[model samples]
Target: MKRALSLLGYSIVGLTSVALGGCGQSGDAAPEATEVPKDFASSGPSAKAVESQFGTPVKDRVATIGLLNKRNNLTQDLVMKTGESRRVGNVIIKLANCERTLPWENPPEVGAFVQVFVEERASVQEKLAWHKVFSGWLFKDSPSLNTVEHPVYDVWVKDCAMKFPGEEEDPAAYASSSSAAKASGKASTAPAVAPAPSASPSAAPSPAPAAVPAE
Candidate 1:
């Protein structure tokens, strides 16, 4: 009985050590395998053509994405240009393209083609590694169309910043111009006052002239 108890205690300690070792894996570990295509994360040859009906080119467009970590209940906003990827904690998010409905379209919608990679193990026996867990278009108005089925993270599209051919001028530019105009108007309206002349010493009295005249 004593020998059996000792062996059991050693086995328990070994198992605990193994579990701790797996849990201590750092997120920076290189992934053993990546299912994403080589060109998937980049602006490949297919992206050379402009896809927007609006005048804004695809590469110039920007997108805002929301990332949530359910484990810690923390959320972060990722603003990125097309074909950009950002790594936060143990996950990497890549943006391929983002789009929105035309001004005339009914029921406007925004979307982005995103891929999410997380560093984790598939099972207890597997080593900690990177995995491409989600890849697809995430729609803002209609989220149920597709979803990120991760247990610890969630990603969604918030907005796509782009321009239509005749869309209104940029708000920032417009505000700056208005401020400049106001300044000019104030300057013009304010009356200018010339500087007053300084007082000068009076000329010497004509005493000499008067004395000569009297003499």
Candidate 2:
């Protein structure tokens, strides 16, 4: 009986030690942390080559973008120049370039090359961090061409303020020219009026020797 009791005690001690070792191993193991990028709002790809006739170089042009926050149903306009970035709340928007069709083009269009970053978690287990949600050219007229896919946000191009070579005609000059033409047309079409006779007595007097001569 003594031998059997001693063997049982030894077995219990070994099982308790193994269970504690397993717990220690699990406590030491941990998930690897994700490395966040230093540049959260990196620029998008380079813009396409544009001719001098196109007007406004890519870097000099300004672009307007619309940012919508679905959570609050609030939309805001973000006007930014090329190579610029703006942060609103936990989101960042970067503009690389913007473009528009020539004034004489048949189907006019405006677009902007943009990158969007949001501080959000990739998954439920992961912590919140800056992640690029979209990066590409977004068109104002044809929004379906490219879209920013995010659950809580939407971004679209509004306008690209740039001009073609002849687009910058002076408005004052145009108005003056139009007014002159209209005035000339009216003058040419008007009927001329004859002048009224003079009221002076010298012009109205006439001699009266006719009755005596008839007898």
Candidate 3:
């Protein structure tokens, strides 16, 4: 009898140990971050067209525009001219690069202008996840110490290509793969939510239905 009781106790301990082991294994395992589209190839020939048109380098993890010398607005304008543009959401972006001559007039600014197109009531808010621009100076001038790089321009280009037709500016067919990912259970990163439109008090509300005339 004593031997039987001891065997029963050992069996219970073994089962409990196995259950705890399984639970620990589950606790250690976590879902990996879903890999959305990273390489520019998914854009198909559209991205390739831009690369060939503007000579944008697609090496490394980012597309490099090389070094640009900021001379004046003229240099900046020249670079802007090289870009093939498209509208993303409410912003218009141009993809181009050039050697800007650092102007000697005022504070002597030397850098590239990754211009972000702003509509009447809209402008670039905070940094959101998207393609970004890469630029730097050739040492003729120095940017303010407080200045930090905002690759929003590149983000704009990729976003625009994915969302809107660059030549036509249609929003529906051209949206980014991120949109499709969101439709699936893949991309969960929420975009910046815009505010709701306000109604004017001058606009009167709809009238209630009149009381029934007949019973």
> Candidate 1 overall Cα lDDT vs. reference?
0.79
Candidate 2 stretches greater than 4 Å from native:
1-53, 170-215
Q: Residue 33 CA error for candidate 1 (Å)?
A: 19
Residues 176-208, model 3: lDDT tens digits:
554675676543433322222234433434332
User: Which 10-residue window in model 2 sums to the lowest lDDT?
Assistant: 29-38
In Å, residue 136's CA in model 2 sits off its true spot by 0.6
Model 2 lDDT per residue over 79-149, tens place: 99887777777788888888887665547799888988889889999999888889889999999999999
Instruction: Order the candidates by TM-score, highest first.
Output: 2, 1, 3
TM-score for candidate 2, residues paired by index: 0.57
Task: Compute the lDDT for candidate 2.
Answer: 0.78
RMSD of 1: 14.6
Candidate 1 residue 83 Cα shift, in angstroms, is: 0.6
By the lDDT metric, which is better: model 1 or model 3?
1
Can you write out model 1's per-residue Cα lDDT over 1-215, one digit (the tens) per residue? 99999999999999999998886685544442333334444534232334855557889989999999999899999998887777787788888888988665557899988888888999999998778899888999999999999999999999999877545755246446778998998887555422222222233454557788676
